[model samples]
Target: MQRLPSDPFTSPLWHFVAVLGINGETGQLRPAHHFTGILAGLIYTARAVVAEAALPSQDRAAMADLPERLAAIRKAWLCKSSYAPMGYVLNLLLYGKKIAFETGSRLAVVWNRDGTLLYFQGRPLAMETIRQLIASMTADAEDLLWDGLLFRPRKAEAEAEAGSSSGRRKGLGLLEREGRFLIPLATIRDDLTQTQRGQSFLHTNGLLGKEKEML
Candidate 1:
């Protein structure tokens, strides 16, 4: 079996994956469709970082420790709030025995048995590329955040924006689109919904969306 990178903490990106149960060398659970949530969260966290960074210096210090803030937010959501339900879903997927890809197909999101991300089929994505993908996904997440925080956009406007982004993506090949293998949209949507629900629960429970300790 192919070995993954030696250092787990080498990238902040891996921290997001770890939150989803992918630990060092061995994953806490089997890989499943729910793994998409890690990707989504990575995207959101990366975008949130950028958003905070762009604020005026005075405002920036107020959010200077965003990663720690997000870490606490995620911990409460994953370990405390929805632990049982999330564990149940994880167990179900673990025992469900789904194939990762079609036989004879070289294209796939391959992982080591220990759950380390290997490559998309034959190509190894650069770390920067992975970060770029997260950044792109953050844009989508930002739109939803804006809608929730402020006034909602018209359905037509939302659809148009989504469509235009999709059109822009069409020029790129699947691998090039975000430097990661593409998951089915239905799967991504379901995963995203779960993540959003978790975030909502966190917000309601006073864990996120306000000034808080970086625990």
Candidate 2:
């Protein structure tokens, strides 16, 4: 009999997983239609941080602190449950075999026995793959960020500001509103199912069309 290819997603161990948002919120993974934006936004944001240049030293220093900041944010917001970033999903898709083991995959997000920290074990190959993936995605995202497809700054503004000394541009950093980095849900569109199309959290809160207004 001809052998069939193994389906990693169909494995029993793959079941019972929860999707985590950028904010570390746990929920069912949205359909691809809605989820793509979240993934794009995150990858783009990470890219922008990695590629940003000519900003004030303070801004540069803040970008340098992104990993620690993300860790702290994850700990503070997701202390109650297991969670993983969207990058984990990308890593899993690109290098599943390298990251998966007999027990489970780190891409799926597992918490420690005491719930102290999220942990994943992988071979060196998996680790390298993840590192390279992050680099590549960040590069791609940087391009998008420069094009203003990910953040709010227009391409013209980015080009003009590239030569400026002021680092006060909006959308130059991660999502911030009211002195917090926590993005309001209104900024995200739920363009997935018919029922969710027009009922985005932002739309429901009368914050829809704000992005266009900003432009």
Candidate 3:
């Protein structure tokens, strides 16, 4: 695979996937678990740092070992991949933070200064994608924070009944919903539905408070 841009502002990019490890004996997102969201955060942070540093080269062989290291940590801690955005939403559950959208509702977590666990509707992430991200993380976590790639390889999925009245479908609690969101060149189209939806959310949420109306 070609090198992924470390800058978050890059227009053409891939969405990285992060998987949360669950307990085999018990079911819950563990804060102290070896594979906490911090690993995902740190990985991206490292990528950003590498991008900014005056580095010598971009090599794939070197990147391949990172995931192995991360997996070792997960195993050492006895954590299993829960298939939810637990790594992403775990921060919100721990601190009074937000993802600037319906993420909390979608992830099914509530907020408080004290510790509390909340249930969410989501699926486990694709193992391949998770592997890709772990291998991609370089040794530059500290500097990556400034470039806004601190949480790059994390995504959330939901479950719904076979059919739903509304377009919104309920997400499964612990499995990654299968299907490809990426558009292949052979199946490309001029449709702008996704762009419009993202824009609508930004507009509705006051992110573009003074921006002109976009159709």
Candidate 4:
């Protein structure tokens, strides 16, 4: 697969596993959405500080010296998270990776036990989302996301269709509103294989296997 950019600002928001939350009363750590919210929140705070600092002297003076305050805030914030540096935090967010803040001080990329990246920061990072980001980054990789010139189905939708076909539709598995195209992970692999083959056909007008296409 073509490489995706690590920038989070422009990336699509994907589904992610929530791993940390802020304490309601004690202000301690609680299990919450993956670190995406915190990461975005921090970035927003930083940008806001910078914007406020750019205002007239009276306004800026009330907030303290711009450079000193930013530096202090950066220092304190950086010290709190075990996450990557601010530069990387921005990059990861741009690329749509799920970020999880471990505590007030540490942040890290969330990964599935099998190592397939899920949603960054409690957002869903589905294959379609990644593929879209990749398409935005590179022209040559555009075809990778097209199946016979049509976009691939979202994961939840495909699953609902499959479930309906199986004649066993009684639960919310097939009723998930957001992920209408969500399919079982197993079907994802199969659909991907077919999608690739179809793309190859559209691009070359001939059937081809992976090795043959590589040649």
| Local accuracy by lDDT, each model | 0.44, 0.41, 0.35, 0.43
The alpha-carbon lDDT assigned to residue 163 of candidate 1 equals 48
Give the Cα-based TM-score of candidate 4 against the true structure: 0.22
- lDDT of each residue in 19-132, candidate 2, tens digit only: 322223343444333344444555465445434432344675657666666566444322223233323434443343333323242253545455544534211134445666
Per-residue lDDT of model 3, residues 1-215, tens digit only: 12222432221222332223453425764433234344556546544544433222465446656656555543332122322233223343344223323233333343333333332323234455555466345213312531244333212433233122242323222212332122124543445566644444323333242222111
Two-way TM-score contest, 2 vs 4, winner: 4
The predicted structure with the larger TM-score, 1 or 2, is 1
Error of 2 at 203 (Å): 2.4
* lDDT (Cα, tens digit) per residue for candidate 4, span 1-215: 01124433332231121222353433665433444556678667655654455545567657656776667655543332323244445654544443233335434455556555574544446665676676446422322443224343335453444343243343234433422222343433223355543343244422335333223
Error of 2 at 34 (Å): 39
Q: Which stretches of candidate 4 lie over 4 Å from their true place?
A: 1-40, 43-47, 50-117, 133-215
- For 1-215, candidate 1 gives per-residue lDDT tens digits of 11123553454434444565553445466344435444445445644554444444576566767667656544433332334333333333343325333223333665555444465643345555676688678756744644555333324434444444455354234223322223334432223355543354333443342332211
Better of 1 and 3 by lDDT: 1
Consecutive 10-residue window with the lowest summed lDDT within model 1:
174-183
Each prediction's RMSD to truth:
26.8, 23.7, 26.4, 18.0
Backbone clash numbers for all candidates listed? 0, 1, 13, 44
TM-score of each: 0.21, 0.20, 0.16, 0.22
The lDDT, on a scale of 0 to 1, for candidate 1 is 0.44
